[model samples]
Target: MQAQIEILASLQTVDREIREQTGRKQRLLEDLRVTERQIQAKKGEIDALSAAWSEREKLRVEKDRVFQDEGKKAMDKRMRMSRIKNAKELQALQREIELMRLGNGELEEELIKIMQEIDAIRAQIQTKESEMAAMQEEWQKKQDELQVEINGIDAAVSEASTRRQTIASQVTGDLISRYELIFSRRGGTAVVEVAGGICQGCYMNVPPQLWNEIIRNEKVHLCPSCQRILFVKPATE
Candidate 1:
């Protein structure tokens, strides 16, 4: 029982290392996920700006078309003036032409404003695209580095698990199962030492009978307070 307890203790040590390594791997993976989300968010920003720029470009095209058609119509009206002979009719036609000219002048100003706005939106799109590219590049490097670290952790965990299995084989199946249960329940401490009639696991007093049994090393004992397996170091020559 004494030697068996020693084997269980060694098994617990390796199991603890495996648990810690697995936890570290999970944290690294979560960090990678967070960075990926940031990259996706950056892409969304660039897409929205591009859509807005496209809409403005469409508006500019329509405004320029209206400006061209209005100029053509005003020119056609001016050609009709040469064909008019009556004084009042000629004067009315001239006034109509003047109104069309003023309307075209207003449209020309609007077209200028639209062009300027399109230029501004294009500039914004360019800036956002550049920023997105840089973010993606940096993320790529970080992702590669994280993946390498995760792989290394995986290899280490695999090796530790093999070692734990070997140590566990030295312990009885019933005891191993019981210890695993306590280990999971007690936050990784399944086996503990008994010293001065006290359970080291919970720092509680051990019953006299249980303390004597622990010292005898004839059977496995448990700490009542923390429910951890108890052992005592045997005296050496």
Candidate 2:
């Protein structure tokens, strides 16, 4: 029975190692997840900026086309003035040409403004793209580092699990099940050592008779307070 208790203790140690490593694996995975999200967010921002740039470019093209068409119409009106023989008709044509020129001036100003806006949008797109590229490079590096750590943790957990299986085979099935239940419920400490008549699991005082029975090492004994399997280390010379 004492030997069985020692086996349970060894199993508990392996289980603790596995649990800690698994937790580290989860944290590493979450870190990778967060890094990936940041990179994706940067990409999304760059895409939106590019879309705006494209829209501005299209607007500039349309505005320039309109300005050119209006200028051509103004030139045609000027040519018509030379064909008119009547003086009043010529004066009227002159006024019509002047109005078209004024309208063209306003359109030209608008086209200039559109071109400036397009230039600014293009510069902004370039800057954002550069930023996204840097973020991707860093993200990849972080991902590689985390993947290596995750792989190491997986290997460690596998090794610990194999050892735990070997140790657990030495104990009875019912005892192993009970220990596992206690291990989970008690936060990875299913077996505890009693020293000076104290229940180490819960730090409560063990009854005198129970302490004596525990010392006999005849069968399994549990701390009344924490219900964990209890044992005492053999006295050393």
User: What C-alpha RMSD separates each model from the true structure?
Assistant: 2.8, 2.8
Per residue, candidate 1 scores C-alpha lDDT tens digits across 1-237 of: 988888888998998998999999888889878878887887788788778878888988898899899899988989998998989999998999999999989999988887888788788878878887887788888889988998999999999988988888888759999989999999999999987888788999999988888898888888988889999877668
Clashing pairs in 1: none
The regions of model 2 sitting more than 4 angstroms off are 196-227, 234-237
Per-model CA lDDT versus the true structure: 0.87, 0.89
Q: Candidate 2 lDDT, tens digit per residue, 1-237?
A: 888999999999999999999989888889878878887887788788778878878888888888889888888888888799999999998988889888888988888887888788788778878887887788789888988888899999999989988999999859999999999999999999999999888999999999999999988899998999999999888
C-alpha TM-scores of all predictions: 0.83, 0.83
